[model samples]
Target: MWPASRIPFQGRGGADFVEFSQVQDPSMSHKVQPLSSLDDLRAVLRALPGPDDTARAAVIAREPTLTKPPRSLGRLEDLALWLAGWQGRHPPTMKTPRAHVFAGNHGVALWGVSAYPPEVTVQMVKNFQNGGAAINQLCIASGVALEVTPIELERPTRPFHQDAAMDEDEVIAAFNAGFTEPLDGVDCLCPGEMGIANTTSAAALSMALYGGPAETWTGPGTGVAGHALDTKIRVVAEGVALHAGAATDSLDLLRRLGGRELAAMAGSVVAARLARVPVVLDGFICCAAAACLKAFAPDALDHCVLGHVSREPGHQALVAKLGFEPLVRMDMALGEASGSTLAVPILRAACQCHAGMATFAEAGVTDRV
Candidate 1:
C-alpha cells in the first residue's frame, strides 16, 4: 500500500534511473501491521528475525573453491557473505537496491543550531524531487532506485533543549511512517536523511545513549564554526540533561531527543530487518538513528553496515562506538544519502565477484598443495 508511483528517469548516455514518487501519505500501509503504542513497537523489536546461517555456510564453502587464494578479496568476501546471510539465499543478488531519504525540520534550527534555515529543508526536498541534488546523480550511477519522504516539513519538532522534541504520540506516528515503507523486491536498502539542524538532534541523541560529553558528539553541521559550533554543543548538552531522567529506555531517549526524520530512519531500519534486506547506513545522523536499535538490543544492527565515514568530527567516534568499519571514507558530509549511494556499486561488485567466479576445478587451475 505504498502511495508513491515509480517514475523512470533517463540518465546521461541512456542510463535508466528508477525514481520513486515523492508523495506523503499519513495512513499506515496495509502491508505492515499498525502500532497502537510504544509497547507494540517494543514487542516487535524484542522479537527481531536473525540471519540465515545455512546461506552463510553455503558462502563459506563456495569461497574456498573460488579461483583466488583465501581472503584475497578481503572485505569483499565478507560483504558477499553478509548479503547471502541476510537475504537468506546463496549467491545473493543486488538486483533491486534502493535508497530512502527522509527529510524533516527541527525547531532548534530557529535557535541558530545550524548554519542553514529550516526552510532549506523544504527547498532541498524540492531539489530532490526535481532530481537536482547530488544523491540523484549518485543513485543514477549506482543504478539504485531513489525515494524521498518528507515528514511534515512545515511542522518542525519542539526544541529539545527546552522540552521533549516530540511527545509519545508524535514520535510513534513518525516511526510508523518509516516502518511502513514498502520493501517489496528490494534486495538492499540504503537509508539516509536530509534535515536542517538534524545533526544537533543526532548529537543530543548520541550523548544521551552513550553517556559521552556533549562536546565529544557535537560538530559543525552545515558549515557552522566558531561561536555557532559552541552554541550547538551547549544546546546538545542542555537537551540531554533535560531529558536524562525521563528516558527510561533507548526508544524513550529517541522520542525525547530525536526529530521526525531520525525516528523515521529508525523505523526504516526495523522495516529492512523484517524484510530480510541488508542495509547500508549513511553518515552521522543516519547512523545515530540506527544506533538506537543497537542500544535497544545488543545485536539489533547485525544486518547493517556503515556505507561511509562522514567528515563530521563526531561520525568517526560514533562509528567506533557502533563497532562498524565504513566501506568508504571520502571526507564527505553532505547528507541525503550521498555517501551511502556511492557504496551501492561496491556492494554490487562484491556480490558479482562472489557469484560469478568459477571454482578451481571448473577453471582447470590446480588447487594449492
Candidate 2:
C-alpha cells in the first residue's frame, strides 16, 4: 500500500515560476477584472501536441519511401508509428531529456548475500558528486542533465541493526522521508542504483516477486568468484526466507531489501510519471525498483526506457518480464546508469535523423503513385 503523507496540491515550491499568470485583454479596455482562473488557458494546453524539433522532423518524414515497384520501408514505417504513439501524435519528440541516479546501501548485505562491501556505495556516491563516475561522464557527453539522489534506506541506525531485524512500521517510516527536489519538465529520466552488495537485495526481491532460485538471478556482482558466489547465493536464499516469515508489506519490502537509494529512485519515477516525463532504466537495481512502482501503478511502465543488458543473470529475466528491450549489450555492472547514458546519444541521433532528413516532396522526388 502507498503512504498516506500527501504531496501538497497547491504549494509549488520548485515550480513557483512555472505557473500561469493572468493576461490583459486589451480589446476589453474598460479596466475590468479577469476570471482569475489559470485553468481556463491551461486546459487548452493539455490538449495540444507534445514534441520538440526531433519529433516535428519525424512528422515531416511521416511517409515511407516506396520501392520503384511497391511495398518498401516495411519495418521503418512501423517504427515511425510506434514513436508517434509515444508522443500522442504522428512524430515523437525527445525534449529536455535528463537522468536521475539514486544511490544507497542495503542492510541485508550483512548476511553475505553479495560480493562487494557496502563502503563502495559511499565511494561511488562521492565519485558521482565529483563527476568522476562513468554515468556522469556519459551523461555529460550526451547532453543529458543529471541529478544524483543520496538516499539512506538500507543504512542502519544505532537502534536497529541486522541482528534485531525490523517490523512494518519501521520500514514505512523510512519511506515517509522525502527527496529535496521535484522532477518536472525532465522530458526523459533514467533511474540508476549504487550499493556494493545490492545484487543480493535485488535477487531476494526478484525471488519474492517472481519466485525463482537465488542462483537463477544471481550473477558476478562487482567480480566475486566461485566460493564467494556460492556463498552469496545461499545468503540471498536465507534472506528471502527471513523476509517471507515477517510477512512485510510492499513498503516494508522496499525498506528491507530495496535500500534507500532504491526507494528514492522508485519515488522519483512515480513523481516523474505523474508529471508526464519518461524514464530510462540502468540495470538490475533500477529494474528491481521499477517492479515496486509497477505494483502501485501499472501505467508507470509506459515511461521507462530500457538502457543496457546487465551481466547479472537476473537482469534479463526482469527486463523480459517488464517488456522492454535493452539498447546496449556491454557487460556493465556499475551501479550508475552509465550504460543508459551511453545509449542516450544514439536515441538523440535517431531523433536527429528523423528531423534533419529531407522529405520525398522537399527533395523534389516524384511520387510512384
Candidate 3:
C-alpha cells in the first residue's frame, strides 16, 4: 500500500491518482495499486524538475567559441551541450558520477528464458560486491562510484506469461526502493539491472510499448541457443499474448511484465530527474525502464543519455522509440551496468572538452577563413 501522503485525491494537471480498493484477484496476496493508469503515474511526471533551458542555451552559445570549427567535434560537442543544458552548468563537469546495479530474479526464468541459472543472479551480486563483475571493473577503471543493490531476488516475481509478474503494491515498493539514493553531489546517475531472464521481461515490455509481435522484440538472452532459444521466444510470445489487452498503456504494460529491478530502475530514473541529475542508461534493460518512464514523463528524456548500444535485437528499436543516439556502440550485451560504466569516461571527457578547451580568441588562434 502507498503511504497516505503519497496518495493523490484531486486531479492535478489532467491526471488522477488511482486509488485501488484491494486486490481484485483473489490469487493475489498483495494489495494492488494499478500503476498502469495515467492517474497513477502522473505524479512521477508532474514531480519532475523542468530542464534548465537557460543552461541549454548557454552551452549552445559557448560551443561556437571553442577552438574548433563549428560542429568540428560533431556529436561530442552536441553531447557536452546536452549535458550543460541538463547539468545547468555552462561547462558541465562529471565530478560526481555514480553507478547503481539493481539485482532481482524472475519467475519467467523457470521457463528457460535464459541459459544461465537463477543462482547466477545471486552469484553475480557477490561478484559485483567483490569487484569481479565486468561492471565493477569498468567502474573502477572509469573512477565512478559503484553500488550493487539486490531487490526481491529471494521472492521472484510471478510468471507473467501465466499471471501478473507482481502486484501493484510490490511494483510501488520496488520503485520506492530504487528511487531513494544519496545524490548530494552526484552529477550523473547510471542505472543498470541484473536478473536471470530479465531480457525476457525487457522484450515483453518493449513489445507491449511498441505494438509488435514477440518475435520482433524477443532475442536470445544470456546466449540461450537452439531449443532453449526457441523456448525463450515462445514463452515471450505467450507472455505478450497474455497481457495483450494492456499493450496500449505503459504503466499497465510494466505492471504485467516488468521485473522488480526494472521497476526500481524506472523509479531511480524519476528520482534522478527530480533531483535535476542526468541519467546514463545502460543497455536494453535500463533502456526499457527509461522507456517506461518516458511513456509516463516524456521530459525525463532530457535528463537521460544512452550509454551504449547493445547487440540485443530489441535495443535498437527501443532506442529509436526514445530517439536517443547512444554515446558509444560497442555491441555490448553485458548487463550489470558494464556498458554504461564504459561510457562514463567519455561523457566526463566531453564535459572536460566543453570546460577546458579555449576559444579561438582566447588561444590567440586565427579563425577558419
Candidate 4:
C-alpha cells in the first residue's frame, strides 16, 4: 500500500479529485504477490494466468450479432474481444484507465548520447506533476488518470558501457516500485517513461535481446543526429557487448543495460497482467522495456497493444519483432505515455460499440440468407 497522501492529483474535466492514500480493493478479486528476488519474479512471469476464455467466447458470440456488417470495424472489433478476454468479463468498460510515467536519469546522458541534458528528465517530471506536459493534456482529453513517479532522480545509474547500470538489489527495488503500484480500480494501464539517454539504453537492450546491429536499433533520441547519432549508436554497441555475456537472461540484460525507468515500466506491465488488466504500451522506450518479458514467455504481451508506431527508427522494428499492429501511427516519438493515453479513447469506443450496439434481432433487421 502506498503511504498515506503520497501523491495527490486533481481530476480532469470536472471529475472528482483523488489522492494516493490507502490501496483500494481492485475490481477483480486477484491480488499481486510481493516479489523479493529475481528468481521469484521469474517464477511469477512463468506462471502468469491465462485470459478468461468464457468472456472471450461471450464477446465472439455477441460481436456477430451486432447490427454492423461482419468485420466492418476492423481492429476495433478485435480490440473489444481483447478487452473482454483480459478483463475476465463480458462488456468490458474503459472507465478509470490510468497512465503511469516512471522517470529516472542515466549516467550515459553525460556522454551526450541525447541532445537533452540529464536535468531535463527531472524537469519533465515536474512538468508532468504540474499537469503541464503533453501526456497530462492527452490524459485529460482521453479521460485517463496520470501518475508520475520519479525513481531516485539524484542517483543516476552508472554508465552501462563502463559497468552494470544497476546491481541486482537495485534492479529488484526499482522493479518492485512498479510492481506494487496500487492498481485498485484501474480498468486499463499505460506504462511509459521519462529518462535522459534512455533511448540509448533502450537501443542497447533491443540489440542485445533481438540480435541486430547497433545502427539497426539506435536512433536520434531527443533530436540528436549527425555525429551525435553516431555516438548514440556506438554507446549502444559497447553497452551490449560489455554485458551480453554476463547477463544470464532477459531480466539480467535489462539490469545490465536498462535504466531504472525501464525496469519500472517492465514491472508495471507484469503487475497489470497479474491483475488481469489490459495494457497500452507507449512509444519506443516503453516497448523496449516490455519486450524483455517476451523473451521470458512467447505470449507475455498478449494483453497489450502497441498504442502507436513511433517515428523513432527502431520502434517500428521493435513493433514488428513483438508482432503487434499498433492502434495508430502518428509519427509520434514523445514518451511520457502520450501515445498510449491518446489510444484510450479508441479502446473506449470499441467497448461502447461492443456493449451498447443493438443486436440485429432487436433492431428488426433481416439476417443474410
Q: Is candidate 2 or candidate 4 better by TM-score?
A: 4
Q: Which ten residues in a row have the lowest lDDT in candidate 4?
A: 1-10
Poorest 10 consecutive residues of model 1 by lDDT?
1-10
Q: Local error of candidate 2 at 361, Å?
A: 1.8
lDDT string for model 1 (204-234, tens) is 9888888879999999879999889999999
State TM-scores per candidate: 0.94, 0.72, 0.87, 0.94
Q: List the residue pairs that clash in candidate 4.
A: none
Candidate 2: 10-residue stretch with minimal lDDT:
3-12
lDDT per residue as tens, model 3, 1-369: 322121112122322222211113445332223344335556657666777788888888888888988887887887787787677767688977878888888998998889888989989876665555677557657877666678867889999899999877788777765565545557788888889999999998888778877777888768987888888878888888898685556776787898888988887777777666788999999998778877766776778888998998889888898898888899889878888888888888888888899988999999877
Give me the overall lDDT of model 1. Answer: 0.86
lDDT per residue for candidate 2 within 1-369, as digits (tens), equals: 222222111112332321111222546322212111223212322333332345435554555542222235343343344444444343444555666666655665655545666677777766765556676667656767666555553353211113223344433333322222354444456667667676766776777677778888777777777888887777677666766556434445555555655655665555454444556678888788778656444555665677787887888888877788877888877767777777676556555555555666787878666
Model with the higher lDDT, candidate 3 or 4: 4
Error of 3 at 148 (Å): 1.0
- Measured over all alpha carbons after superposition, the RMSD of each candidate to the real structure, in angstroms, is 3.3, 10.2, 10.7, 2.6
What TM-score should be assigned to candidate 4?
0.94
